[model samples]
Target: MSAAFSFNRIVAIGLWVVGGGTALFLIAPILAIIPLSFNAEPFFTYPMPGLSLRWYNEFFSSEVWKLALRNSIIVAVFATLLSTVLGTLAAIGLSQSDCPARATLTAILISPMIVPVVVAAVGIYYAFAAVGLLNSLTGLVLAHTVLGAPFVVVTVTAALSGFDQNLMRAAASLGAGPVEAVLRVMLPLIAPGVASGALFAFVTSFDEVVVALFIAGSEERTLPRQMWSGVRETLSPTIAAVAALLIVFSTLFLATIQWLQGRAELQKTHREE
Candidate 1:
C-alpha cells in the first residue's frame, strides 16, 4: 500500500508540473507584451529605461485607433445579438427528440468552426462581393454572426442536456402556448447558457481578423485589423498597448463566464438535491 501510494503521488506531481509548464508557455507572450506596453523609450527591449503610459494615451487619442475600436464594438454587438437569437433557436430545435437529420444539421451549423479561417474568408469575400456587401459594416456583422453562432448552439445544447422537458408539458397543460412555455419556463432555466453563448459570440466576433481582412474595407477596420496593419506598417508600442487592453478585457469577460458557469452548476446541484 505504501509503495502504491508513493507511485501515485509522483504521477500526480508530474502531471501538475506538466500542466503548469504548458499553461506558462501559452501565456508567456501575453505576459511579455503587457509590461512592454508601458515602456517609456518606445521600443521592444529588456531593461526598460522607465515605465510610461504614452502608448496607451496614443491608442486612445489616435483617430485611427478610435475608429477601429468603434467599428469593433459595433460589429461585435450586432453579431452577438444575431448569433445569440439564431443559435438559441437552433439549439432548442436540435434538442427536440423527434428532430430529423440531427447529426447532419449539427455538422452543417458548426462547419464555420471546423473550416479553416482563410478558406471561409475567401468564400465569404466572393459571395459577399456578388451581393455588393464587400467593404460594408453590414457584411462584416453578418459574416461574424456566421462564425459566432456555432458557439451559442454548442453552449445552449449543453445547457439543455440538464433541462427537464416535462416542464414544457406542464406549462402546456396549464394552457400555455409553445412560445409561452419556452419563454416562461425553458428560457429562465437556460438563461446562463444563453448568456455564456452570447459572450463567446461577442469574443469571437471581436477577435476575428481574417474575415475582416477579406470582407471589410478601410472604413470598417476593426481593432484586430488595425493591429495587423500596425505590425506591417509602423510596428509601434501602441499596438502593444492595444494588446494589453485587450488582454484585460478578455480576462474580465472570461471571469464573468466562469462565474455564470459556477452559478449554473450550483443551481443544477440544488435542483438535484
Candidate 2:
C-alpha cells in the first residue's frame, strides 16, 4: 500500500510540473512583452535603459489608437449583446430532447469556430460586399456575432445540463407563458452561464482581427487591426503597450469567467441538494 501511494504521489507531482511548464512556455512571449511596454528606450531590447509609461501615454494620446479603441468597444459590445441573445435562445432550443436534427443544427451553428479564420474572412468579405456591408461597422459587428455565438451556445448548453427542465413545467403549471417562464425562472437560474457566455463573446469580438480586417473601414479599425497595421508599418513600442493592456484585460476577463463558473457550480449544488 505504501509503495502504491508513493507511486501515485510521484505521478501527481510529475503531472503538475509538466502542466505548469507547458503553461509557462505558452505564455512566455506574452510575459516578455509586458516589460517592453514599460521600456523608456522606445525600442524592444533587453537591458532597458529605464522603465517608463511613455508608450502607454502614446497609446492613449494618439488619435489613431483612440479611434481603434472606440471601435473595438463598440463592435465588441454590440456583438456580445446580439450573440448572447441568439446563442442563449439557440442553446435552450437545442437542449429540448425533441428538437429536430439536433446534431446537424449544432454543427451548423458552431461552424464559424470549426472553419479556418481566413476562409471565414474571405467568405464574409465577399458576402458582405454583395450587400454593400463591406467597410461598415454593421458588417464587423454581424461578422463577430457569428464567430462569438458558438461560444455562448456551448457555455449555455453546459449550464443547461445541470438545469432542471421540470422548473419550466412548474412555471407553466403556475399559469406562466413560455416567454414569461424563461424570463422569470430559467434565466435567473442560468444567469451565471449567460453572463459567462456574454464575456466570452465580448472577448472573441474584441480580439478578432481577420474578420475585422475584411469588414472594417478606416473609421471602424479595431484595436487588434490597429496593432496589426502598426506591426507592418511602424513597429513601435506603443504596440507593446497595447499588448500589455490586452494581457491585463484578458487576465481580468478570465478571472471573471472562473468566478462565474464557481458560482454556477454552487448553484447547481444547491439545486441538487
Candidate 3:
C-alpha cells in the first residue's frame, strides 16, 4: 500500500525481466542449432528442407566419430576418478585446523581454473612434449585432470563449509581412526557434493577442446576436437548434430547435480526435524 514499497517492487520486477531476457538471448542460438541438426539437408540453416535422422546415424556409425567418442569417454572417466580422489583429500586436509599453508596450497591446486585455457594448453603441450607424452591418451587424461580437479576441490570445500569438526573428534573418541572417521562419517554426508564434483569433472573433460587440440594425438582425438575439425575441414549438418548431442549431455549433468543437491537438502532437513 505504501509508495516506497511499490517502487521497490517495480525495481525487483524490472531486474528479473532483464535477467531473464539476457539468459534467453544467450541460449537462443544454441536452441536454434538443435532444430537445424535434424534438417534433411546437409546444410545448417533456418527452416527445414524436411526432417531426417541421417546426421545422427552418421555420428553413431562413422568410425572417426566412434573413435573420438571412445577417446573422450576414456579420458573423462580416468580424469574424473583421479580428480575426485585428489580433490576430496585436499579439501578434507584444507578443512582441518592444523593444515599448513592451506591458502597457498589451494591456490596452486586450483590455478588451472584461474589460468586461461590457451595458456594452460601451451604450457601443458610443452611439458608433455618434453616427457614424450605428446599425442597420447595418458597425456590427454593428465591434461584434463588438471582442469577438472579444481571443480572437485571447490565443491568439496563448500560441502565441508558447514561440517562440524567436533563430529570427527567424537568419532575418534569412539575408537574410529582418522581414515575410518572420514570414510564412515564424513563421506556419507558429503557424497552428494563429491558426485556433483565428479560429474562436473567428467563434463569438463568430455567437452574440452583447446587442450585436446594441443596435446591429443590423431589417435586420441576427442568429440570436441573432432567437431572442431569438422567445422574447419567440411562444415556440415553433422557438426550441428554433434553440438546438439553435447548440449543434451551437458543438460543431463546439470540435472543430475540438481537432483543430488535436492536429495542432500532433503536429508539435511529430515535430520534437523
Clashes of 1: 0
Error of 2 at 122 (Å): 0.8
- Which parts of model 1 are misplaced by more than 4 Å? 1-10
Query: Could you give me the TM-score of model 3 versus the true structure?
Result: 0.93
Instruction: Enumerate residue pairs that collide in model 2.
Output: none
Give the higher-lDDT candidate: 1 or 3: 1
| Per-residue error (Å), model 3, residue 64 | 0.5
What is the model-wide C-alpha lDDT for candidate 2?
0.96
Please say which candidate is ahead in TM-score: 1 or 3.
Answer: 1
> Candidate 2 residues 1-273, lDDT tens each?
999999999999999999999999999998999999999987899999999999999999999999999999999999999999999999999999999999999999999989999999999999999999988899999999999999999999999999999999999999999999999999999999999999999999999999988888888999999999999999999999999999999999999999999999999999999
Off by over 4 Å in 3: 2-13, 265-273
TM-score of 1: 0.96
Encode model 3's per-residue lDDT on 1-273: one tens digit a residue: 599999999999999999999999999989999998899998876768799999999999999999999999999999999999999998998988899999999999899999999999999999999999999999999989999999999988988876767889999999999999999999998898889899999999999999999988889999999999999999989889989999998998899999988877776676567
Cα RMSD, model 3:
2.0
Give the TM-score (vs. native) of candidate 2: 0.96
